[model samples]
Target: MQKFILTAMLLTALMLAGCNDNGTGPKKENQPGEILWVEVPDSIQIPPPGKFHKALVKASVQDPDGLSDVDSVYFYSRKPDGSLANKGLPL
Candidate 1:
């Protein structure tokens, strides 16, 4: 029983020490958030020649600081050639 207790304590100490960082890495403070989810139409009817249609876009984003920390979100469309349709448009 004494040997078992000592081994367990040693294992616990090593695990804790491994989890402690010595601050050698760069800090990630104020980092930008990530887009968690996005919603867009799967298909849309084509407009007549010389006409156009607009699709609604929605996105869910998260930030380490908070939602308020996020400044803006933009969306970019890709053409059939895999090129950006235009400069990103603000959402």
Candidate 2:
């Protein structure tokens, strides 16, 4: 049950963490970086109840300007209730 909840939260967070838009609509020259792919485990195992489980998540991004133009990539998780996690951990 815990694993399922965690998985759902992770998926939701990723969906919310989509690329940023300038708000003026799509411009070819002002296009933001594209997320090539993301990786996450199908299932995660937690040992003792209080013990924390470390899940690996990775994302590959590309920018029209260049890799240097990319500022940063962050990972944040959502709560089971579909809310942002404790102010969101920018990891």
The best candidate by TM-score is 1
Task: Write candidate 2's Cα lDDT for 1-91 as tens digits.
Answer: 9999999999988876674653656665766889889997755665697787888888888888889887777776665687876487764
TM-score to native of every candidate shown: 0.53, 0.50
- Residue pairs with clashing backbones, model 2: none
User: Which parts of model 2 have CA positions greater than 4 angstroms off?
Assistant: 1-30, 42-51
For candidate 2, the per-residue lDDT at 86 reads 44
RMSD of each: 10.4, 26.4
Which stretches of model 1 miss by more than 4 angstroms?
A: 1-28, 42-51, 87-91
* Candidate 1 accuracy as TM-score: 0.53
lDDT of each: 0.79, 0.76
Evaluate residue 76 in candidate 2 and report its C-alpha lDDT on the 0 to 100 scale.
Answer: 68
| lDDT by residue (tens digit), candidate 1, 1-91 | 9999999999988987897575676776687799989999866677999998998888888898998887776676765677666554533
